[model samples]
Target: MSEWVDVHFQALETCGKRARTAANMLTVEDVFQDSSAKQPADAAQASMFGDLSHSGALAGKVNDVWTALKEELGTGRSRLQGVEKAIDQVETNLRKATRAATV
Candidate 1:
């Protein structure tokens, strides 16, 4: 005989909400503009490279990395939203099943 497994849909919902909240809080502007580390990053690049051409390259690379991070976060948020939708569908189906069974 197979044992019954309990699924905590509420906990899953809470997790989804927390993840979305975190993702929303870390917007591209917040990461780039509002960050305290921007000046330090520029200084470090300039100190290490020590030339105008290399400085430009390092700056471009840094910008590219930030852009990539932003894109990745957006993708993650979209995927989490999809998961939330799936969870809602599953909960709805389970409720319908329980109701039909009781009837």
Candidate 2:
């Protein structure tokens, strides 16, 4: 005889929804659009201070860091979406199996 396992479909659905919502909210544009660090660094690079070679190097470093952060956020969003999809699939499969067994 196999052991019976209880699965909470509603809770899984809720968790999937939450993960999707979180993933949607994790966009780079939304998070970094109004960043003070980016604005100042960009301004500094575009202004007279940019004439200095050292200023350009510093600006480059800042841009690199900014790009890395955006990439990380994108990666995180992708992972969250993947998890949400997997959860949805699991819920669907479980429900189908339960129905088939009852019939």
Candidate 3:
């Protein structure tokens, strides 16, 4: 049981720290850059596809997908904070259980 508690605490701490780091790293600008990245279609493909100049329907769809993805990534920061809070609660509960066991 003591070992179990130690393991859970360690896992949660690692998870929380990693989550926080990931949340910080995944910023809106990064997402936007990722979304906006473009490669010119090859000559044959461009001729086959037609109208290679404008951002067309497919580009708009890609933007929409990226917009949704970016919003989801934005939530990760709060989710990490929530995980840390839950870990604190679990630690408190474990301490209580330990005290009760000693009694």
Candidate 4:
């Protein structure tokens, strides 16, 4: 997990946020409109409304997943950096060993 990977993951998170916002806005806007006096609000109408509500909730959940994944990605990036540093150190040590052996 390099910085590039972390950045890409963050971009995905941003997309998730935008999607969530859009979903919520659609549902909230519909909520603001009166549901009419019809009982159960017609099966088709109810289903459509329900779908919007469900989508809004799903969007929220997706956002949550992205948030958690972002944190994990940060941890992964740090871990990878540490590994790279360690590898560099080992390479330096190996080079020094080779020079000493040559001498």
TM-score of model 4 vs. true structure: 0.40
TM-score of each: 0.60, 0.75, 0.51, 0.40
Which has the higher TM-score value, candidate number 2 or candidate number 4?
Answer: 2
Which residue runs does candidate 3 get wrong by more than 4 Å?
1-8, 30-59
- Measured by lDDT, the strongest candidate is 2
Q: Candidate 3's residue-wise lDDT over 16-37, tens digit each?
A: 6776677676666654465666
Every candidate's lDDT: 0.64, 0.77, 0.67, 0.52
8-103 per-residue lDDT for model 4 (tens digits) = 556555655554444444432343467653322222223344657576566566667655655665565555555555655655565576568768
| 4-52 per-residue lDDT for model 1 (tens digits) | 3134556656766775676565565555675665523332355566656
Ordered from best to worst lDDT, the candidate numbers read: 2, 3, 1, 4
RMSD of 4: 16.3
Candidate 3 Cα deviation (angstroms), residue 7: 5.0
> For model 1, which pairs clash?
none
Residue pairs whose backbone atoms clash in candidate 3? none
The best-first sequence of candidates by TM-score reads 2, 1, 3, 4
- How well is each residue in 1-103 modelled by candidate 2, as lDDT tens digits? 1234343777898899999999998886667666764433342252445476677778667778877877998999999999999999998898788888888
RMSD of 2: 4.5
